[model samples]
Target: NDKLKFTIRGSYINNLTSKNSRVNLNTGVTWFAGKGWTVNFLNTSSFHRVTNNTGSSSFTSSYFELGINKSFDIQQPRHKYYNYTAVFYKDLNGNRIHDANEPGVSDVLAEIIRANPEQDLKDKNYNGEFLSNELYSNDKGKIEYDNIVEGVYNIKYIPKDIQNAHYESEGTEKQFVAKKDTVMYIPFMERNKLFGKISLHRTQHSALGDIPLGNIKITVEGNDKTYSALTDKEGYFEMYIPVSDYYKVKINNIFREHFTLRQESYIIKFNGYKRFELSFDFDEKARKIHFDESDFLITDEEENGNVSFEDIKVIKQTNLRGIVKDANSLLPIHAIVSIFNNKTGELISETASSRRTGVYFTSFFAGDSYTIKVKAQGYWTYTEDLYLNQITTFDNVNRDILLRKTYIDEEIKTENLRFKSGNSELSALAKAELDNLVSTLFLNPDIIIEIGGHTDDMEALSVNAKQLSEMRAKAVADYMKQRGLSEKRMKIRALSNHDPKSRLDTPEGRAQNRRVSIIIAGF
Candidate 1:
C-alpha cells in the first residue's frame, strides 16, 4: 500500500480599463510514497492587460503551497481509506461562489455520520477511532475526502453564519451486525387483519387495466402504533397490525394524493381471525374514490332476533291507497306528492313520478291536518288541505285527489258563493274568498267577471225577489271593492225576484238558493 497525495490550484483576473483583457490559470500534481507520509505542491497565477495603448498596464500574481498526509487505523479497518467530498458556494457580494475562487478557499465544514446512529459509535475528535467524520470547509465552501468504506452516511453542512444542515441516508447496507438474525414476535391477541383492493380504469371506456402498482405504502394508525405495508402488484394489500382500541388506514398514491379510512374503536370478538376487505375504483380524470367499510359485506351479531319476512309483508299490505288525477279531464296525471303536517310543516311521506297515471299509497296517523303538495316538474305545485279526522277508525282510506293543471291562460274561477240569510251583508268566509279574487284580478287586469245575485221562492214574488237579489249582489260588490278590486271591470246585477234555481221546501234546498255567482263575461 502507498500513501497517496493530491493538490489542486486555480486563479482568475479581470482588466476593467482599456481593452479589458482577463486571464486565468490552474494546475495540480499527485505523489504516492511507499512509507505513508506523502508530500505534494500546487501553484496558480493570473494576468490582466489593457489593449488600448492610450493607458495600457499589466499585472501578474502566483501562489505556492505544500502539505503532508497520512491514514488512520481503526477496529473497522475497512474504513481506513474512506473519505467524503462536498461543494458549497460563498455569499460573496450576496451571491454564491464562482470559478475564480477555486483552489484557494479554506476552512468550510463538512460532517459525515452513519445514518443509523444506534449502530455506529460516536466521537468528538478526528481520531478516526469510530464511525463518523467532520471536516472544515474551504474558503470557497468546497472540500473533498476519499477512500471511505461502503455504508450509508448522512452528510451535514454548517455554513458560516447560515442555518444548520440536515439530510437522510437510506438502504440496508448501512445496517451493522449484518450477519445477525433478528425476529419480531406478534402475539395473536395483538394482531389485526386488514384487506383492501384498488382498481385503475380508463376514463373513457371504464376498462380495467392489469398493470398493478406495487410498493404503495399503506399506514395503519392505532394506539400510537403505525403499521406500514407495500401493496402487491395486483393492488391488493393485507397485513397484521397491533390490535388497538381505535384504528384507521391511510393510503398514499404515487402521485402524492392520499386517502384515509377510519374504523370503529371496539374489540373485535370472533371465534376466528377477523378480516375485512375494502374495494375502490380509480378514474384518471377524477382520481381515486375510497370505499369505506359500509361498501363491503360484513356481519354483526344482534342480541334480539331479526324481524321475520312474514311480519314485514303484513305491514306493507296495510298501507293506505290513493290515486291522483287531472281535475278538469278526470284523467290521471303524474305528480310528486309530499305529505306534510299542517301545523309543524314536517314531511311525513313523499312520492313522485313522470307518467300520466300517478298513484301513491302510504301510511299516516289520524287526527292531524295533512297538507299534500303535488308538483310536476314543469307544472305549478298544487297544495291541498285535508283533515285526517275522517280516518280515525284505522281502516284503509282511499283518497282520489284531482290535480288541476295550471294553465297560463286561465284565471281563477269565482262562482262558488254563500251569503247571510235575507241580508245584504257579506259573510266572513265570503270576504276571504273575495280577497283572493282581488289578488287574481290584479294579476290579470284584462279579466272581467259579472256578479249576479239570485233568491229562493219566498214572500211575494216582487218584494222577495227585489230585496233578496239586490242585497246579495250589493254584498258581493262591497267585498270586492274593499279588497282593491277595480269597479271598472266588476259588474253587479240583481235578478232578485226573477230567477229561482231551487224550491224553498227544505232548509238545504233553500240555503243553496240564496247565493251569488261570478261569470266570466269577457277577458
Candidate 2:
C-alpha cells in the first residue's frame, strides 16, 4: 500500500509527495501420509517499490519453509538389489588399467542413461543425439546406479578440457544391463594427437634453372567445408585442416589477371599419416604450373588454425585468337599453336587451328610477352614472339603464321634457335630444334648434309657478322656429332648477309634473315 500528497505554492517549486507500491504472493502444500506422517511446504514472495520526484527504489524477497511430522505408520518400499559401481583408473600405457605409477582419475563427469528394451529405437532426445534418463557421478570418481529397473543402460564420458583429457567408448552402447548389480570399467584415451606442418613451394623448369612460384592462392575442399590459404613470400603455407583423404583442390592466380595454369580443378588425395608431409604434382594438363616441393614435419601445436590468405593475388584471363596459314598459298592450314612465356620459355597453353578456316582461340593475361610455336604435319615449325599491352579492354591478336613446306633442299625456315646473348652457347629450345635436325640426318644416312648460318645486314662490321654466323653453324654441327653422327657426315658453312632469307627492309624481314638452314648434299 502507498499514499501520495502534493502542495502548490509558487509557479513550479512547491512540494512533491512520495509514493510506494507493494505486491506479494504465497502458496503452501501439505503432503499427508496415513497415521500422522505429514510434510508441510510453504513458499512466499514480496516486491515493494518507493518513488519520489527524483528516482525510485525496489526490493524483492522470497521465502520457502518445509516442515515434516515424524510419528507415522506409513512404510517405505524396499528393493533388494546390489549397487552398480564404476572405478576409473589411468592407463599410463593407454590399456585402460591402473598400473604402477598410474592412479585413479578423480572428478570426471560420467553420466548414465537407461532405457527400456521394448522402447522404439526412435526414442531419442530433442536433438536426436542421445537417449533420455541420465544420472551424474559422485565426486569420489565412482558412479553407483542402484536398483536399476530391469532394463538396458549405458555409461558415457566426454573430456572436459581436451588439451588434458579425452576418452572413447569401447563399442558397448545399448548392450550393458543391470539384471543384477554390475561394475563397469570404462576406457579413456589421452588427448595427445599427431600434428604437423606443411610447406608449399612451386618449382618451375626454365632454360636457366628451376624457379619457385609465390603468392599462390590455394583451397582444400573437404566433405563438410572448404579451407583457404595463401602462400607466403617464400611460397610456403601451412594449415590445420580436418582429417580428409580426398580433397578437391582449386589453385589459381585469377585476381591479378595472370593465367598461370588453365587447369585448377584437382581431386587430390592426402595419404593417411599421424604426421603427414607431402606436396602436389600436376600432370600433362598442368601447364605453366610449378610444383616446388611439399614438405611435412610433425609438431604438437596446432598453429594452422590461424592461417590466413590475405596476401595471395588472383587474376582473370583474357581471350586470344589467331589463324595459321601457308606462306606460299596464304591459305588456312590445320596446325597446332602453342604459347609460352617469352622470358622463361615455360609452356602456357596449346590449341589447334580449325580444319576448315584455320581459326584458333586461346586465353592469356595482358601486359606480357608470349612466344607462339606453330607446327603442322608436312610443314617446318615456326615460332613468333609478340607482346600484348591491353588489360582493361583486351583485343584479340590476329597473328597468322606462314609455315613453309619441309622438302629436300627447300631450306624451309623453322623455329629460330635460341642462343645465349653475344655468345654461341645454345639454349634449351636450340637443343630441341637440333634434335629434329639430327633425326632427319640419321634417316637419310646415305646422304651428306650442310648446315648454313645466315645473318641480317644489321651487323655494322662485316667481320663480326661473319664470325657470329660461322660460330652458330659450328654449334649446330657439334650437336649432331654428339648424337652418334660422324663428323664427316656433316659440314658447316657460314653465309652472312649475302644470302638473306628476305630483303632486310623491316624488322620482320630482318628476323627471318637471322637463321640457320640444313642443306641436303650429295651422297
Candidate 3:
C-alpha cells in the first residue's frame, strides 16, 4: 500500500458579469517499484457553460496521461559483503580430481587470518594473526564465512584436528584475496610410506649369493588394520599406512612353507612423518628367533632413520664357470647346467647356458666333490665329476664341456625303466635309464618318437589302468621337456595292460610289464 499513490482534485469558478461557470476535475495514480522506479497515470476533465449569451451551452473535454519515473537517491554506501569457502574432500583414487562419487569430509574446522586490510586504518583491537571466530564445515563439507571485508587472507587447518590418521593434507594453508566470493579446495591423501625388500638367503656360508624374491606379496598389519604391496622386479614392496603404535610385517605364507624365516613376523614401533626401510630373507637353517624389539627399531644413536635387519657377513662365493659347445662343430650350445653334491646326493644349484655365448656359472661351497651335468637341445648331455679341495680359492673354477651331436635314430629299452605301483613319478632307476634317452633326443632334434606306457595286470579293476599309463608317459615327456627337449618331437601312447614286454604270469614279468618304451617313429 505504501508503494502505490492516488490523487483526485476538483475546482469551480463563477463569472459575475457574463454569468459563465467552469468546472475542472483531475485524477492520478502512481505505482513505485523498488530502487527509485515508478509508473504513473493521470486523467483530467473540464466543463464550461455561458448562461446569458449562448442560452445554456455546455461542453466537456477529457484526456488521459501515462508515464514512468525514476529517482536516484545518492547516499553514503554500506559495507559490501564477501564470502570465503573452503571445500574439504578426500582424494579416494589419488588422481587429485574431486570426482562426483567421492564424498566430502565434514566438521573440518578452518581458521581465517587477514593478511591485509582494505584500508590502512588499523584499529587498536585488530590483530594480524587470526580472525575473531573459527569456521566449521557443514555436512556437505563446505566451510563458508560471509560478510567478510575486502582484503587478503589465509585459510589453514591443523593436521592433528583432522582425526583421520591415514590421511595427510595436500595443502596446509591457502592464501587468497577475498575481493568477492572465493572458493578453495583442500584434499587429503594416504600417509606414511613403508618400503622394504625381500630376498632369499641361500646359505650362511655363501653371503654374496642371496637372490631377490620378485613379484611376491608383503603384508603389514597394525591396529586391527592391514595393508599389502606386491614386490617389483627388484623384490621391493612399498605401501602407505596410518600412524599406529606398532606394526607386524610378514611375507606371504606360501613362501614361509618353502623357506624358513629367522623371525616369522617382525614387530616395530612406528611414529608419524618418517619413511622406513627394511629387508628380510628366507634361509634353510633359519631358526625361530625371539622377537627382539631393538633388532628392528631405529634408535637416536643411528645417524639414518632406517630400520636395520640382521647384518649378514659378506663372504666370497666359490663359483663354477664353463662354456658348452658342440663336440664336432665346436659351435656354442645353449644348455641347462646342474650341479649335485657327490657325498650328500643333493642338488646344489642349477643354471642355464647363454643362448648366444653358451656360458654358464653357479656357486657352491668348497671342499666337496660335485657332479656337473650339461644338457642341450640337438646335442648329447655331458657329465663330469670334479673335486674342489680345501685349497680351492674363491676364484671361479673353469671347466669347459663338449656335447656330441647325433644323426641316427636309436632306441634303447630297459626293463628297469618302470614306474612305482599306482604312481606316475619316475624312480631313481627309471630316471637313470631315461637320462640316457634324453641325451639322444636332444642330440637329434629331428627325431620324433612314440613313448609307450604300460601297466601290470595286478589291479583287480582296469579303470585306472589307462589313466596311470597315460600319466607315466606324460611324466617321461615332462622330464625331457625340462632337460631342454621340445614337446613337438615326442608323441605319447597309453597301451595299458594290453601291451607287455614279458609274460604276465610271474611277478618279475609283471615288474617288467610296468615299463615305458621309447620307439623312434621318424627322423
Candidate that would win on TM-score:
3
* Residue ranges of candidate 2 with Cα displaced over 4 Å: 1-82, 97-101, 117-140, 162-175, 204-523
Task: Compare the candidates by lDDT and give the number of the best one.
Answer: 3
What local lDDT does model 3 show for residue 129? 30
Candidate 1, RMSD to the unseen true structure: 27.0
TM-score of each: 0.25, 0.26, 0.28
- Candidates 2 and 3: which is better by lDDT? 3
Give me the displacement of residue 160 in model 3, in angstroms. Answer: 28
* lDDT (Cα, tens digit) per residue for candidate 3, span 261-292: 76667887655445878887766554333657
Pairs that clash in candidate 3: 379-443
Give the root-mean-square deviation of each candidate in angstroms: 27.0, 29.8, 24.8
Better of 1 and 2 by lDDT: 2
Quote the positional error of residue 432 for candidate 1 in Å. 9.1
Expressed as tens digits, the lDDT of each residue in 1-523 for candidate 1 is 2444445554455545545776767666657664555567776767766667577777887777676666533435443344445555432221223345323324445566666555444533224434566787665455665555545565665434332322111111212222222211111122446778766655552212222355566777765556687777677888764434556666764322222223212233223445656654554554344656653433353215443444332211113456777777777777777778878878977755325345555544443577777665334456677654552234465667776554433434653576546666777777878887776556456667777887766533435677668778877877788778878887778876455557657767766777887765565
Score each candidate by Cα lDDT. Answer: 0.55, 0.59, 0.72
